[model samples]
Target: MATAPVAEAVSLDHRLGDVVVRLEFADDGPVRLVGLVSADAFDASRPPRPRVTPLVELSFAGESHVRHSHGTRHRNYAATSRLRLVERVADARRLSVTQRDPETGLVVVTTIESTTPTTVAIASHVTNEGAGPVAVEYLSSLVLGGFAEAVEADVFRRLRVHTCLMAWTAEYRWRDESLADVGLVDAGIPHPTSSTRTSYSFGALGSWSTGTHFPQGAVQDRESRQLWMWQLEHNGPWNAELDDVGRDVALSLSGPTFRQHHWSQQLLPGESFSSVRAVVAPVVGDVDDGIAALTGHRRAARAAGAVELPVIANDYMNCLMGDPSTEALLPIIERAAAVGARIFVVDAGWYADDAGWWSTVGEWRESRARFPNGLVEVTRRIRDLGMIPGLWLEPEVMGVDSSALGDLPDEAFFRRAGRPVAEQGRYHLDFRHPAVRSRLDAVVDRLVAEHGIGYFKLDYNVNIGEGTDVDASSLGAGLIGHERAYLAWLEAVRERHPGLLLENCASGGMRADPAQLGVTDLQSTSDQEDPVLNAMIACAAPSVIVPEQAAVWSYPQPHYSDDLNDFTMIQSVLTRVHLGGRLDLLSPAQLARVKAALSVHASLESFIPAAVPFWPLGLPGWQDEWLALGLRSGQRSVVAVFRRGGTATVLLPLEGRATILHPIDRGARVSEEPNGLAVTVPATPGAVVLDLIG
Candidate 1:
């Protein structure tokens, strides 16, 4: 008699805050993160899946997997399929699951921590305990299956993905596409299969974590109005993909892969490697709900010193343009203090003489030629004007002609094939090296102690292609190591100087990810100089970043009209304003207008930290005529609208008594309706912000 043994299946339903996760285990297979839902939608009595896959995908030596160029799953490996659950631990706020492969002695542990009621941060680590080494090609930080199980309809047609198109100067542009449109369709008709050949993926390729695309994505269920948003918290190359798994969809978020980033890791005995962190937020409503939950988590993750959200004035955007001299900065500092700016930052070109500063920037010495009495003269003046002094430092790069290059050894910089990796006349520093970190720490300490500097603008302008291949592993793996070391250095710096504020700028937000934003104080939204283009970026900034952390430029030129002044002023009134431009050259009327805008910003700054952003006109497009961003906290709401070149009138879905906050005499009118507000601007290129109380 022949008998078929029943499949061994087990499931654990864990709840953390308002979110629920279902962990599936099988005797013949690995444990899997099969389900994620809000507490309200979870049912404890539901049966578990008979078959399960690995929660952590590890592509190692002597293994083969079914994978496409864009996906990260469908691997048929005995190492993963035979893995057995070793331990499970949980609490009210966190959960940990551990599994091991007995044959190879490879262990994987996944930890999920609750950041908000609906947001959870997930990360994994792999340990090699075998006698021999294991070469890993691809490892996932987060892998979630059955993503579309809650939707009873056709998952492909009812699901939509929103991707952020990020680049230099053009950042945070969102594009929405259907799952079917991206080729993740149902291929099985009469006979169903779990394998699919297509996947929709987007990721960054180099040191610029947000260069080509932001490490952020969102999936929306059009039928049930469910939304799932996630961001991979890595400062270097990363990838995110969505593909079909049987009747459901799956998501894979990871730092680097052999296929994508040329990343591979050789793990020796008793060695462990940790993957990057990723946060997932589940909501039962639209995009706003997802953003609100993520925003709450981000605020809680910020450093203690960044709670104030102070106004900062930098002289690099459209005013001085990186040429900072004592004579040129004293007047600007006076005007900035007059306009109520809390911090004055001397941006770039402060460390070099008139000969040129790009190829000799690593020394970070105050140029006596630019400031005859040394930088102390300018910094002291900034302090005398009632503003905290700040300076820009690119700590991760060394100029080819830098004097420090001769003092530091070859191991201190990034190397490939026995030579230092150079890009744009600069050599990238390998933060993994202790010597590199020490040099940076000494530079920071010297500047802070000598110049009374309270703020540092950490700008990274160069992107070294693959990464360093100096010590061990592949180029991408080396990059991951350096990124982790860089974060550690940043944390150490913050600990040493508790009151210091660090602004993250990578040629203007090329490295603006949660990994950086979670540690830094503020992020520059863009380097876009055109006021019109900057307005569109300001409107969409809150979708990808928290409103308080998004530093939008409000640099108004002296020759601009009154309407144009309002337009530029409104660009940053709601976010952290990075004031620049020739304020010292403005006429009395223009200066008065600038002062009035700053007064409004000061009054509303308290609400900026706690407020969650929404768009009454939906997300703005690149060339959209009208753009709007709304921030709501408590019972009060603030809406900033701009008319680039469209009709003068646009209706917003809001209900309240509205009062103009800026440009009080402008021809803009706000008429309250039963459930909406009818807003009108008398002219194009006009902007306005109104306070609403219901």
Candidate 2:
């Protein structure tokens, strides 16, 4: 492979046990990039899949699989990568490359989207041929340069790629791998793969083999720096494929020279195989951070191109009461001015999407029965109160009642005409069409100009569907075209509402990838209602994102239950306190308590969001009765702690004397140490404070 002559380029270094970045630009255009995966990363035990075989003439193990369209194999290859590239040929500025896996027969596809000469967008898809009953897994080792230091390497700036989280089809929460109907376990985050430094593993998902291994010393492309490994298993799956979404994206990557694993979902003969598109551009920082910086670069590019935006919010799956009535929002809007909450969000209900709010999205209408006066009145109330009203929208899907039903082409969907496509909640939108793009733009424009929605909560939690949803005749046409459509939509909206705040969701966390980082201002942690879960998320969130963007919401109750306690309630709103819990539907006294809690949070949040340089103050969360986040801004520091009681003696990590707040009574006391002060919590109460040290 010929290496491009190097000019000033992005570089990497390490900080706080992680990687840091320094991106320098190429003089003329993006630096040409490619992958050099070490053969050592591949197990000597497994065989590699075939390569660069033309998609039109696939001869898998000499067993020819004919391309079928309209119930006929009109051509030897109906949908191939060669055809996929044609979709994006017109947009040369967009990333235009794809590749395949050498082992595991998993089809690997990618696309490079460069918003700037220095920044590039990388999108990858990995699938299998549903060949032999095989288990497929993925592991991409992004080797850094020789000038990089490994000790200080850290992953910074992660954004949500997919943000929509759906309540399970049957389970109230998530399953270990798939959905299970009968269990109280929301299993909010199922462990798909156990974390290991050397080898990452994952459980079986919809179609592929489940885990990946991380080799500790596989940072190739350098002769100096030693490498470390961070193995990961798939958390679960979030498919955006509607019928053939995966196939469409795959066909666009290149020809069918991929490693694949085949399996039967049931005892029946079921297979899962895919193709991919790709491009590798030299980027800065650790791999994750590089992705974030590039995403920011792209958003900036579009902003420079004139994308108009207004900030907004929407109450979604967690805070929903299943009604979109104006009255449902009275309390939230009522408090807007006081807390300076700029936007009042009403999720799901306002639009007459399907028979209910959860399915059949994209229809735009006011449910008169739900909102008696109309959304116009609701917006008036919000504006009158000096806040903007935002609506939650799932433009990527259509329900059974969608007007576009049976009216659109088959190429827009993932399933074959009669094949079993994963149609769990609704029909996934085919963003591959310009017509669809225009309709969506119109929807946003009308909503913003007329009803006055300042924000859009775009949630896409389910997995991408297969590309077979469209007619077999138009196979693969949706490939790269689909990506262009999505980017165009975002670019247009930014040009339209350059400052509009968009909250992205993909089943909550699945969509938070680097490509969409700064494109979205606020991001969620997870759709967790439990403080235990919230505490768990808190431990990890500061490592990647700013606190303000985390979904650190806690209610006075268990979100769905009335079992409330002062300790439990405080536990709920500690991070990003929305003080939300069916607010319009809360008891009078309970509502009062919520306001009180918010008041306390108001004081603490300033510290929480700005309290950088945090350290775990004596392993606080391990106490089933306690939860805390400790921070240091300079020499001055404070630790927010709440105890569930039981003569607990918590260790203080601070060396200097500090003052502490007695969680109860909002009282304060100075510590008596040799130097100044260091405090501890009283047995049954909690504490918040101003800690000072010399």
Candidate 3:
């Protein structure tokens, strides 16, 4: 007996704490994202407003129609084609939607999991089901759009887009633009026109995942005070776009693609591939509210058995600059521990025996010339000082003159056209090869066992564009495979050395993507050495990374004045202070100030993990004279304000009753106002940390 499919419109709604997601289905037809609203804004009594946006969009080879063109003719079948729903399932924490395209033999299973009250993590898995290989051009992890209310005249005026631009020295530089200014909306009130269609897209090029821009953004509706924030959690080529689909705006988050980065994946029968996870959250307040929700989500997503966020002193930045030696680091180590650094890391040059050691790096052993008594003496000194021993290692690359370059198998290195892809006197390793993993494992194990090393600062310096075509269908696929293998190796390392702590750095803050961040313990915020310039990165980093995991360098030298020393120390106290610089060269008074700041950091360390960040002075401008950031936990809050070149008195919005408002240094004066705090600063640069007991 032939049975006809049910023709009724079916929908399912799931609530995760304060957020609601509703999915709609038409019999066995296409699936759509009908609703994604906060619990406070959603009205059950009103008729359902089903969004006309596809849940997932995919482009495959041999397809003719362009579903949603962004100034290009690309075959995007899943964009417009009817994706028949195979199954839908939901639980208290997650909702899964399974859909299949009959023409391409592609099955996409989208899962949305709630990590916090207001944040949902989304990921899509694509599998090839037919006999022949399917060439995938585009696969978006998240495709959300169709906000009709935003198209109204008044509402459209209040719409703004927020994205953070990043670089080597200046990271987390935020830029806010109106929807009309960004061409996402028309000039006049709501109207239909052929010229209204536009797309604003941005992404990174290679391994320096966040070199150009961060893979995170937010859209805010000022009238409703609602913000939608999202981040693509990948460490490689990634793209995010804001598209005008005629009636409404759309957002697509995906990795590399054929049209954009010459990336394509050929999936054979029964083969499957998964897109990088995209986390999206909706908050009912301002950007702070969105950041709070995302912070909670990040806390929930962190790996279990993570190390405590402690004060770490790395001998880099204003200090050694990859020239560490026994004589140079011993005094620094002694002073670092005296200032209460829980971890003392010997950053770079520990394995170098010559000036030309940069191109001869793959050997992880101690340098006989640099450390006469071997590295064990230094590690022992660090441990005896009541601190964990740490070292800097660039694990994924072999220097061009490295002996391992010839020792390791050719398949272990990334090769393009039978030649190793060399960049900046280094050859990238293809982690997909077992030889590469074995070599890294041996080096890590030897270091830990030989030196009793408890911490590792993993750094990646150069970008090997696209990737090498080895053991994969395309260059992008090869890169994806290597990334997955690297993640697996990291997991294995963590499993083996459960007590080891790893810090992620990329020339620094370049590879601070959620994909790599999910596995590592801390992130180096930036390599910017100047305290005044680093203030901008420190103030804005919490929006992209958890404050507890953001490692900001506080490097004070002898030449710095008392106010300058206080400014640098306060920059790191509010976050994971990666204390650096010539501690051995600092004067007694300057060292006292550094130790006092560490005391304050220790007092507040217990509350950092539970704290949610808020920008009292809004997102800091690149050239802003005054900047402020607050962290609220329970009824208490900690606010850090910096005065670079501002007026004498600057008013800061009060988060609560100022119970303990005091300057960490000597020149700054503080007073309470009716609705805010009036801070008076000297002409010289200074900073202060305020502890508000609500």
Candidate 4:
């Protein structure tokens, strides 16, 4: 394949709020998504000159296309090459590009809708109209190429790929690497026939959507000062790849694929399959602007749920550590009420009769031995203390030694090869089964009605490997069904209760993708007990979730020093504070300090939901001695600065009157510099939250 002769090609251009999407139909080839430029920056003269990435890249069984690296690259599949633009429909907020493959009678409709001024939601639907069934392996949800059109600088060197590295406790860690640094470099050949041999491909493989890497990231063009951020809105296996298409770069986002997640779907005649939804934002600014656009998209796309950010005190982090009993909770409850906690969540082990709760959960019954007066007694106490009662539940898994297994049918749990799928001594419940959903619904209703529970911390602890194969095409296909069904069940629960708050926690942020976050009211940022390390997670969490929805833990232990106590408080001040610790054991001075910090946090609640995040010192490293994160709402901003023992002077590129919002008596000095504000933290382990008023 070589460069085609220069000829004028027809394109269907549609302005989607903030960007102009141009679909090129050239020389009887596939309709390609060539231009996705910002409306303000769209260049009408430079229409795409070469074959860009197709809108829908599809691969089926036994179809071959010439000049396509079938095994190496996912672009230019045979099925996609035969797809021609059949019909297109557009409205004010959406554009639907429908392509037909006459050779196989496959219809691919790529629907793009403006989620916000700078973001769009995209998904592809494939339908088979042939007489025979087609085995489908790969299909892209969204494809955007031609980064070379953004700037004149070297695309490989100037384009920065921001990849999010996630782990159990250390989640939301961002790594910025250039294409050349990631091994995808320009070969210096003119109009190469195939894609680059190597690509910067990353994805999650199991049920934990963010088990290894976050499903969202940004590609920044440093020369043009433009950024394209995207999120694969799927709860199961998903993949995203950045590869070179000739001199330009392309991004392919999709759900589970046969090659990646052992997933394949057989589409019979008159049947259709839809890919996972992906939200993308292309902005003409830096990474912060890109994130702000995505935040706006998330805010616009999600339903109107609860907006109040209440202070929740859960007995899990440094206090109860899961073994919660009436004997151990009364003092903590009093202390929580004393510290202005609006919600009191009794975490795991509340249902256990003894210490053997690990392998005997899922009954959802209050343990008589743990709560002698029944769970209602504690709920009543919580209500009397002016706090809503909540409970932690791992609803998706039944323990191996639980009595509930005798009541559930084998089909109710995830099954493969005529057996239930067990992971870490727990059987994963298939929410696709009515029995499973019904049982969980009963549990929730009973707890809410009888115990007067107002909140539920939904925690998922185990990952049932690929998926169940019971009545399904493949493992990944079954997982997709269950994932969609689980989300539906969640929405149904919310509909029924309407006022109950649901906190999403999967072993702490493993399932923190937008698909889960969109429905849940709060997202547990991490289970990391060390507040010093949690600071890194808190600052970076805004890149993934909105500040008001991110529930970062602030557990100031009684044994901690004054500086350490303030450090822990600062970790969650900018975000939703999931307050936890042995507050009952804290001295008067420590309790006063904690109360003062929470007071400051309460005062800034109105500004957080509307604010966007900015890092004055850039995204923090794991061991970065000093860290600063700011949430800006127009001219007003609140900056949380932490000194983990580096240079005392912290410089911020903004000039405003900096008043100490928290720890007013701490020895932190602020001065107006010629270029910015210079803040001096006199102590090594000091922390401060500054309110900048211009």
**Which candidate ranks first by lDDT, i.e. highest?**
4
Assess each prediction's global lDDT (C-alpha) against the native.
Answer: 0.84, 0.40, 0.81, 0.86
- Ten contiguous residues minimizing lDDT sum, candidate 1: 66-75
Off by over 4 Å in 2: 1-320, 336-340, 353-355, 404-407, 417-422, 465-488, 557-577, 584-626, 631-638, 642-647, 656-694
lDDT of 3: 0.81
lDDT of 3 by residue, 1-694 (tens): 1212425776666786787887777865568776677888776666665455567777776663443453442223443365787877777788888888887678989998888888898888999997788988788888776454433445446778899999889999989998677767654523332224457888898777899999998888877777888888888888888765544666788888876766888989999989889988877888888878888788788845333668899988898888989888899999988888899999887888876777888878889999999989899999999999999999999899987677688888888888899998999999999888888899999999998999999999989888888887888888878877887899899999988999999999999988888898889999998899899899999999998899999989899888888888889787899998899888887788888888888887778877889988999988999998889888888988888895778898774566334453466666788878887778458888887876
For candidate 4, the lDDT comes to: 0.86
Off by over 4 Å in 3: 1-6, 27-29, 67-80, 150-155, 187-197, 303-307, 659-665
Q: TM-score of every model?
A: 0.96, 0.57, 0.95, 0.97
The residue-by-residue lDDT of candidate 4 on 518-603, one tens digit each, is 88988999999888788889889988898988999999888998888998998888999999989999999999999999998899
User: Would you list the clashing residue pairs of candidate 4?
Assistant: none
Look at candidate 4 and tell me the lDDT of residue 508. 96
- Which order, best to worst by lDDT? 4, 1, 3, 2
Model 3's number of clashes is 0
lDDT of residue 61 for candidate 2: 31
Model 1, 1-694: lDDT tens per residue? Answer: 1212224666777898999988786676678787777886666776655323357776786675543323344244446665678877788898888888788788988889898888999988899988889987877887776655655337777888988898788888888888777778877632223557567777989789999898888888877777888888889999887767666677788898787887889999999988889898888888878888888888777735335767899999899998989999988898899888989999999988874788888999988989999999999988988889999999999999887788689998889999999899999999999999988999999999999999999999988978989896898888889999999999999999988999999999799998999888889999999998988889888887898889999988888989998899889999999998898898878988988888888888778887999988888889999999999998999999999886788889999889988888889999987768989998789999989997
* Tens digits of per-residue lDDT for model 2, 1-694: 1112334433211111112222212333222121212222212333322122222222223222232222111112222222222111113344233333232243434343444444333344444543443322212212112111221112111110111112222101111111111111222222211111111121223211111100001111122212221111122221111011101101112211212212111111143433221222233323333323323443443353322222232454345544656666676566544444557777766876334656545567777876777788888888898886777777767765565566456545545555424466566556766567777888899888887777777766555432332422222223223433565677678778966767755555444433333456555545665544445444434333444454444544333332233444454333443344555555665555555655555555555544442434422233345445555545666555554554554554446766543234433344555533344455354434445554
What value does the lDDT take at residue 337 in candidate 1? 91
